[model samples]
Target chain A: MALSDVYDFYRRMEDENVILSFKGEFTSELLTSILHIMETKMVTMGISPKMKKRVFNVLVECFQNLYHHIEATGDSPKQIALQKSALIMVIHENEKIIVRTGNYIPSNGIEKLKERLSFVNGLTEEKLRELYQNRLLKNKLSSKGTAGLGLIDIARKSKNKLGFEFIEINENTSFFCLDVVIE
Target chain B: MEILLLEGSAKTPEINFNQDTGVLELRGRSIPENSIEFFKPLNDWVDIYGSSPKETTQIEVRLEYFNTSSSKCILDLFKRLEQLDGNSTEVKVNWYFEKDDEDMEEAGVDYEAIVDLPFKIIEVEEI
Candidate 1:
């Protein structure tokens, strides 16, 4: 949290081509503001309106996924603190925008998520569209307000594989990170 | 039998559901943290309106962006409109997208394929 440390972090972010990032509590209100900043940044960049709209859509889905991903955290103070620090960062690389998010999830939940991500990433565009529609018709919304279509929607929108990793934090918890590309 | 009107916010959509006219309009963004909760009343209204609906029920969806959660709820809202079985109501949806927003257009197409209602995917200058 020192000034030089902050300067070094800024330098590293610049080096890595990170345009925007947040690492803290992910509330709906806060995410809305983050999206506003991103939309404004895109407007200032003078990118085409089409690309701006597409990137904004992808960003909303990413944060909504994060909302569903980490909102059901453990209630203990330490666990709450750890879960509150969910991460979202946007990277501009090679004329493509990459949106990434990270959050803590129960270790037991990893299998289902991993399966779903792989399922989404492994499909062709046609099959992906069909799968998305099928899921849309079949699955009901869960108690967390997700219908299991977030990954599929992200995959279809990006037209690229969804990159993801899970770092084990403890026997009962793991840190899940997801990267989605916006072309 | 009252009109349901809710103003839009940074993370929610503007809703104008007229029970008498059977003209429901949903505009703006719908990225609420919990869309199921946000849309429950509207969905139920569709069901209640089904009980005594106008001859033509027109729904206009001019959403700039909606989260995945809202996407499902939006579909459910459409499904409710589709399930109105009486001859008194003929339901249709106008899913409007900005001309440059191919994603929004495709979103309309996606819903059209899944929901068994008449959908007119129209292109507009802006929402």
Candidate 2:
């Protein structure tokens, strides 16, 4: 990338009040480091203890979603599963914090994800709480035990409808973008 | 029997379960990428503790932050405690949050609503 291009990118991020942004391989260790970084940033910014905790909690759910849903590549079955070049941004908009994640997903999975997103976005706060409790009690965690728990948790914490977009990358893949706003 | 003691990590919580006093404490941050793997042992210990529980069981949760996965696992641990014979084993959960951490307090309330056991949301001076 040219220096001018890099400067333009930074300017855009600054305009968005992006406190933290990352575009790279998503690993477990990276997630830990990102949380630490975010915590320190929030503390330095003098965010209220309660709001900082809320932002941190929402970020955790977002990072986990990126880790679990980002499509893995390679033909070898023994290869390590890692998300290559996922993007995450924590932006302060007005008095709210917006947690955004962008990653590629298999085309086959996009429909189900869209349905889940729309379902979560359609509910009121009371309904969201009800659904979270119901899922916690009844839903079975898949082999990894993720099983949409993160989504429900995110919805409950944000207390706002989820926003998402699907950008087609190819015949078999699309870039899934999710945004959570915490007031 | 033996006590369960696990040190806290950057991404996991410290678990201290006393077989004698029946005071199980979880402290620190819990954002492990795979929380189920980290919490399975804690959940299993609760199973054993339930079978031969103390008269009064106090579980203290002092987490600064926990991911969605750990949230589910924590609930599982609490659900296990709920299975203990209420007449014989009395379970009380004290959830501690930093002062003014309304989100954490609300989280405790949510957990209280989900589990049948007694849960108290306590505010600490600082994390």
Candidate 3:
């Protein structure tokens, strides 16, 4: 809204070590803007080529998940607006790049999210590998409807455990926060 | 059969496959929103192409990034090609990696270990 407000918000983001943050309508236009900004930042930082590509891949997957998979309802207009103002922060901490995405989740989805995470977390690296391979062999190439493997892939790529929390908002909704750190 | 040439997005790869030329090329990042949907047509196209049996098929893959799921689809594609090659059809995979990207180089080697196809690992400079 105000010039000073925008400036202060950006300053606060920077002060908080947020390298990147997006808070706008998540339309195709907005998605392109985010991708362009990320590419420019990676180029400017002179990040390793592989890391640059990896970051781009992660961005694409995360945005797609948010756009198509997240459950929405009649009251989702407010949630969508909040998502437009949602925080996607990339912070540098402990010699790792931490990408934090925050958004609201329907109360009912919390259990499924937790269940998926627990199932993945319980696996040994070898077991995870085996599971991935088994899925590959058994699944057809046409069945791609949120197999709950995106987070698992994230964990595998980062080689770190996932950090998440559920902030209760109301009886029917909660704010879900996921923090993934890539070393 | 016609060739399909689609540019890669942040989530997919640039594909260049021609039924006539038999020079299939896939380059760029691959972490598609729906791995199966994105790769299904490619796999189906490859299956059809394999039936025709090209005299020589060169598949050049220059992927900078791909998720674990994509890795599986890639393996499946390669295995299909390897099977078609059994009929004396010459097939070669030119797997390219950035000079400093050991992960990609090793991935090429891994695929080679599993498939009985002629695969070559080519190191290229960062673009």
Q: What is candidate 1's lDDT per residue for B1-127, written digit by digit as tens?
A: 7899999998889999998788999999998877889999998788778888999999999998888788888988888888883458898899999988888898899998888888999999979
What does candidate 1 score on TM? 0.91
| Most accurate candidate by TM-score | 1
Model 3 chain A weakest lDDT span, ten residues long: A140-149
Identify the runs in model 1 with alpha carbons over 4 angstroms from their true place: A71-76, A169-173
B21, model 2: CA deviation in Å? 1.0
Instruction: Sort by TM-score, best first.
Output: 1, 2, 3
Candidate 3 at residue B89, lDDT?
71
Q: What would the per-residue lDDT of candidate 3 be over residues A74-133, giving only the tens digit for each residue?
A: 456875576444456677655567777777778888999998877877877667655655
- Candidate 3: CAPRI quality band: acceptable
Compose the digit string of candidate 1's lDDT tens values, residues A8-31: 998999999999999987777878
lDDT of 1: 0.86
Tell me what fraction of the real C-alpha contacts between chains A and B each candidate also makes.
0.83, 0.55, 0.31
**Pairs clashing in candidate 3?**
A24-A84
- Could you give candidate 2's fraction of true interface contacts? 0.55
